[model samples]
Target chain A: MTTAVLFDNVSRHFGVVRAVDRVNLDIAEGEFFAMLGPSGSGKTTCLRLMAGFEQPTGGHIEIFGETAEGVPPYRRSVNTVFQDYALFPHLSTLDNVAYGLMVKGAGREERRKAAEDALAMVKLPGYGTRRPGQLSGGQRQRVALARALVNKPKVLLLDEPLGALDLKLREQMQEELKSLQKSLGITFVFVTHDQGEALSMADRIAVFNEGRIQQLGRPEEVYNQPKTRFVADFVGSSNVLSTKLCQRLGVKAAFASLRPEAIALAAPSNGALSLAGTIAGQSFLGATNRVVVDVDGARIAVASPAAHAVPAIGSPVTISFAARDLHPMEDA
Target chain B: MRSEKSNRAPLSLKIAAAAGLAFMHLPILLIFLYAFTTEEKSYQFPPPGLTTQWFGVAWDRPDVWAALALSVKVASIATATALVLGTLCAAAISQTRFFGRETISLLVILPIALPGIITGIALRSAFSMADIPFSFWTIVLGHATFCIVVVYNNAVARFRRISGSLIEASMDLGADGFQTFRYVILPNIGTALLAGGMLAFALSFDEVIVTTFTAGQQSTLPIWMLEELIRPRQRPVTNVVAMIVVVVTFLPILGAYYLTRDGDQIAGASK
Candidate 1:
């Protein structure tokens, strides 16, 4: 796949603080890529650098095979849907949607027709005459989407585009945005702190922590085979156990991450990786019963079906997982 | 029961507000009333008869027209100068972070905060040192000293309220820097600029102390009014012009209030 955007050892610093440290990433063309991290993890800063809003202090960025140095955002073949929408308050919905084409010096009739079509694609047809203030939050968000998409950019940069929406609306927008990207065949660089959002919408996700990409892969791959403790913890619920490998099970790392669902709570098994512990807490989820067991000095969580019969808080239990289920992660 | 308590304090507050309004406007009302009175020279509690004959007389005076034209010209020039400088300064200050930003902001605000006489004397001394002739440009320069503060205040506040992300969004959407300024930033700040320009014009129109110090022989409408007040040849005409000033100034003030009333929400939306 052709690389749509590449960050080659790029780093950005604000005074003494390094916001983005020595980052290298390659986002493929027509890929719906997500940068997932906690706030201040430099995900937003990374997006801003790609958008040409900020220049990297070290190294270079390439977009569509062209080096992006000293390139203003407008010169780049990319568009952004800002977090707050940033629809023009003074202009009507039509004008706001048509702003990009109008700035490109498109004719009045052409802009009107293009804007109408873009607005319709977002499922807001006759909202043309209403000001942004008059529109609902979802409608305003759609207007912002239409405004960016009207230009038909090679890449669409969404900075937590659905961050402002309520849960239900955000879910709906995530699907819509994904479908829109698929149909348009344009690259999408979505930034979000919400793990669920990234997991749901991305073709691939770059999991960032402390200004570095800990792991980048398909959502399921990243979740199942996390390379770092931070990635395993960040991507999904995993019980990171401080383990001394009693025997080599073909994995190289010293520590293992046992996913809650992968662990089986039972009496000490004869031929599995077994650890004895006392149950410290228990909670019953609808489908699964979660039990936290204190193994040595570490607390390990295990999830099993409610039908499996969970142990009491003080009951001694041996939690075991198959050798393959013990996913090893690099030491922190 | 809730409505009763809610209404009680507001009722007393309304009465107090009304009293304050009367206290402020009673003198202007007197001027308006006397402008239409039959009595031409001396003051009286109530006029003998209502007539607009003095308005006709005021209209006929060549000096009144001259002063009115000069005032209009000075106001127009000063407002234009202030708008350009103020907007440029505001955009410059808002777009970048530098050393002494707060100090620069304070310096920009100092002209309006200082007494009018201080600004006037400062401008006078500066003009004297430069040996520049005090003509129409001098009056405009003097008016602009304070007018720039008004425009800068409005523009900077409006600029600060706008989200930097919006500008970034615009550029990311394929708008050049000029296009972003023209389409995004300009449209967003239009109401603020209008409010600022209106206030600057109003300030320049009635500025007497600064104009007196800056204007050598050229007289503005307020200076003319002051001359008329001292020597009562056409006292009622001065009242007539004062009535006009009140109306002109009042409309823009009302306009500015309404424009800025929803400003907070505008800021929130941009963010």
Candidate 2:
């Protein structure tokens, strides 16, 4: 697979603050990639750099094998769906969608036809004449998508596009966006702080913390095989055991993390590392029960099936998991 | 309880509000009332009869036409100048950060904040020191000083309300800087600039003190009206001309008020 976007040791510093530290990354062509992080983690900065909204302070950035350094946003072959939608309020929905074509100096009739087609692709056909102010939040988001896609750029960068929507709408849009990206075969780079959204939609996820990518891999790889303590704590609810505790279990590693799902509430007949502890808390989470066990002063969480019997809080119990389930993690 | 409170505005407050409105507008109403009065000399209450002959008289006078023409010319020129300079100033202050931005903004608005008489005196002294002769352009320049403030006030408020993301989105969608401005920034601030221009026109139309200092032997509508008031020739005709000025100035102010009246929201950025 060819690399669509490459950031080789790219860094952006705003005075004393390093917003995006020197980072190397590659996004393959036609891949659905996500930059996931909390606010101030520099995920948005990376997306902006790709869009040419910001120039890297050091190192190099290439888009589709061409250097993107010192290029203005209009000159780049990348489009962005801003977090706030940012549709043109003064123009009709059709006009807003056709803006890119107009800027590119296309004929009026041709741009209008393409804009309408793009709108239909986003499932908002015949929404041409209405002003952006008249549309609902979801409709406006679709308009923003239509506007970005009208240009048919090499990469589409979405900066938390569904952040303003309600939970139900966000989930629905996520499905639509994924399907759209698949059909278009255009590389989609989505930046968001919502881990669930990133995990559910993106084929690959980059977990970022403090201006650095802690880990980057497929969703399951990042979640199940986290390489750092930061990633293990961030990607999913994993209990990271201290190095001293791991030595007690005969594992020679700086730190070991175990997923809640990997931990069994009952002792296994097969040889498995077991820890006896008292149930500190148990909460029902639909299909699963999250049971927090106090084991040797460390609270290890175990995700038990909701159908099974749950021990009362403060009750003594033993949780067991196979040795292979514990994954070694680097101290970040 | 809410209905009762809203329905019964306190009697004293109602009276006070009515009194305040009458105090402000009664003089203008009197100007309209006296326009039709048959009385040609001295102050008269409830005149013996009313006639429309003064309207005919005011219409026939060449001086009245000349003054009206000059007033329109000066206001038009001033408004145009204000539209360009004020908007440019507002954009610079609003869209970019620079040292002393706040101070420059204060200075831009300082012309309108100062008393008109002081502004007039200052312009007069400065003009005399510079050995510049007072003429049509001087009045236009004098009016533009404050007209620019009016435009800047409206333009700056609208500029600040515009979201920065809209500009970025335009650029990201393959629009150059000029294209983004024409397609995004201009539409957002168009109504505000138009309203500011209208207000500036109205202000310059009826201006007298600054015109008095800057106009050397030229008589704009207000200056003409002042001379007619002091010298007392065809007094009812002067009242008729005054009525025309009142209507001409009032219409633009009203237009400006409505244009900017729910202007907090720009086109696409409205919540």
Candidate 3:
């Protein structure tokens, strides 16, 4: 796939604070790329820079091989779905959706037809006459999507688009937005602080921290083999064991990251690393039972089948995992 | 289930508020009431008869017509000038930040905050120093000084309420700067501008102190009213015009209040 959006060493600073520090990223055409991070991690700043709402203090941004410097946002071939879904409250849904086409000076009939088609694409077939204030939160969000998508932008930027919805609605919109992105066949650069939203939607995820990308890879690759301690702690729940190299296990490094699902309660019959522990706590989580095991003054969380027999609190148990399960990081 | 005590204010406070409202409005209301009365010479409460002759008299007077026409001309010109300058100032101030922004904003707001006599005196001084002739243009200039503040306050407040993301969204969707302003920013602030224009027109229409200083021999409606009060030919006719001013000003104020009632909702939508 061709690169659709590229950020070349883009850095943005506000006085003494560095919001987006020398970030390099390339989003592939038709790929849903998500920037995942905690609040204040500069993911939003990167999105703003790409949208041209903010100018980078240094470096360059390109969309469709065109340098984006000194280009006002309105002249860009990208659209953003704001976190609050900034729909025009005074205008009806159809008018709001038709705004871009109207600005392009399209004929009134043509713009109306296009707006109707776009609203239909978002499954709000005939709610065109209603104002944004009259719509529900989910409907308002869909209107925002339709308004942006109606412009046929080369890239669609979503800044925490589903951040305002309730959990069930958010999950539904996530799937809807993913399918929408796929059907449109346009590059999507999504920014979200929610790891689950990023993981579920993105073809690849860039995990950010302190104004830099800590790791960027496919969701499973980043989750299964996180590059840093921050990534390991951020991407998914893991029992990150900080250990000094007692001995070299082949060519792998000392510090190990064992996924919760990979650790087994049964003792190792074969030559695998084993640790004796007591079940500190256990909780049933529908399909799985998460047990916190206290091992050598360290807490390691283990997830097993819900039907698996679990020891009582303070009961002694042996936790074992194979060498391959321990994905060690080369650098601390 | 509400207690009566909760509904009651302190007796002194209630009496004070009543006194203040009465003091402000009693004369204006009396003017309206007497516009229909038959009294021709001196002021009298509970006049001997009621007639609508004063409206006809005020309407027919050539001097009243001339003064009214001049007031309309000055007010329209001042309001138009203020709207253009004030909206531009609001847009410029809203988008970017630099040193002395607060000071500049304070200066913009200062004309309306200061006593009208002070603004009148300042305008008179400035015009005299520049050797500008005092004509209808001078009256417009004086009225626009305070009128710009009205328009600017309304426009800036509305601009501040609008989401920056909406403008960004417009641009991201392939709109140029002018297109964004035309479609997005302009539509969002249209009501605000209308409301501001109405208020500025009202202020300019009724302005007296500033017009007195700057108008020289030319007479606006308020300056005409001041002259009519001191040397009255038909006293009831002046009251009729005063009633007209009240009605004209009242409508726009009501319209402005309704226009801004949902302003918070628009602001909340962006957050």
Candidate 4:
């Protein structure tokens, strides 16, 4: 399959700050890919570069194998669902969605019919005549989606498109967007800071930090085997095993990262790395209980099944995990 | 339950508001009342009789017609110049960042903030130094200097209020530069520019100080009114023309007020 979007050594610098350091990436055609990072991590900047809103300060970018250097955003064959759903306040839903077709000089009736179909795809049928002001937050989001999809571009870039919605609505939209992408078979490059959203939806995820991609892989690989300490800490809650603990466990790596769920509260078993520590505290998290164990001046968290009996704060417990669970992380 | 104190203001505040309104509007009310007075020469507390003859007399005077036409022409040209220049300046300042950006904004607004006489004196000196002849265009040029400020203020505020993402989204949706502006930027700033134009027109119509310096022999309506007041001919007719000026200028000011007030509450910009 042809590459949908490629960034070759792309970098964007604003004054002294490097927003996107030299980065190379390739997204497959018709794949749902995510650029996941915290604020100022350059995920959104990379998206903007692909959309032709901002040219790379150095290096190059390509869309469908075409060099995108100096291309104006209007000439690019991509659509964006902005974080704030920047719909035209003056135009009705129909007119706003038809804006792309209208600009291309399509006849009124033809554009209107397509806009209506697009709205229906977003489950906002019969919302054509209403202005954006009349719509609720979720409805306005749908309108923005319809507007972008009406144009039928090869790639759709979503910049935290669900950022404004309430939690429940956001989750609902996430599912809707995933199914929509699947049905359309179009490439989607979603930029977001929410790890759960990225993990749940993206076919592959690029975890970014400090203007560079720390790790890029399938969600499970990034989660299970973070290549950098930053990726380990960012992708999820990770316990960085102290050097003393690493020595005690017979691991020779500089630093090891183990997920909270990887360790469990149980009697020492054969074929597992075992450590004796005092149970410092326990917090109930519905299905699982997170227990912080203090061992040799380091606090290690162990995820225990909530069905297990709770140990007293001062009780000594042995935590065991398979030796393979300890994933060595790159030294800083 | 809703508190009564929150629903109704204190009595003193209500009285103060009423006094403030009267203070600002009572003079305009006096202008309206004097326009109908039958007395011709001396001021009277109350008009001895009311007559509509002054309106007909003011309408027939050739000089009055000339002044009115000149005022309309100058205001039209000034507003046109302001719309083009001010909107362009607003777009530039709001969209781009560079060295001295703030200074340029301050300079553009300085004419409006300074005393009108100061602007008038500066314009006169500049015109004299350049050896440019004072004519209809000169009056238009003088009025545009301040009119542009009004339009710039409105346009810049609206432009800043607009989300930058909207422009990017428009362009990302395969719209060319002109198409993005037509669909996204224009609708957002249209009302603000309209309000600014109306206000600029009203300001130019009643402008007197700058016209005094730049108009040379041309008598705009306000200048003619000044002359009629000094010479004291058909004083009631002057009052009638004053009424016309008040009505003409008042409508646009009212229109501008409503237009800008609605602008603050944009149609779909709740968040």
DockQ for every prediction shown:
0.51, 0.60, 0.49, 0.62
lDDT of each candidate versus the true structure: 0.87, 0.91, 0.87, 0.90
Return the candidate ranking by TM-score, descending.
Answer: 4, 2, 1, 3
* Clashing pairs for predicted structure model 4, backbone only: none
Give the lowest summed-lDDT range of ten residues in model 1 chain B: B262-271
lDDT of 4 at A321: 92
What is the per-residue lDDT of model 3 for residues A40-125, given as tens digits with 9 covering 90 to 100? 99999999998888899999999889999888887888888999888877688999999888888899999999999999999999
Per-residue C-alpha lDDT of model 3 across residues B118-178, encoded as one tens digit per residue: 9888999999999998998999888888889989998998898787777777777777878
In order, the interface RMSDs are 3.3, 2.1, 3.6, 2.4
Q: Where does model 3 exceed 4 Å of error?
A: A245-254, B1-26, B32-41, B44-57, B232-234, B261-271
Root-mean-square deviation per candidate: 3.0, 2.3, 3.1, 2.5
Instruction: Determine the TM-score of chain B of model 2.
Output: 0.94
lDDT of 4 by residue, A199-243 (tens): 999999999898999999999999899888888888887888867
Candidate chain B TM-scores, in order: 0.92, 0.94, 0.91, 0.92
Candidate 2 TM-score over all chains jointly: 0.94
Total backbone clashes of candidate 3, pairs 3 or more residues apart or in separate chains? 2
Quote model 4's TM-score.
0.94
Report lDDT (Cα) of residue A25, candidate 1. Answer: 94
Superposition error at B15 for model 2 (Å): 4.2
Model 2: interface root-mean-square deviation in Å = 2.1
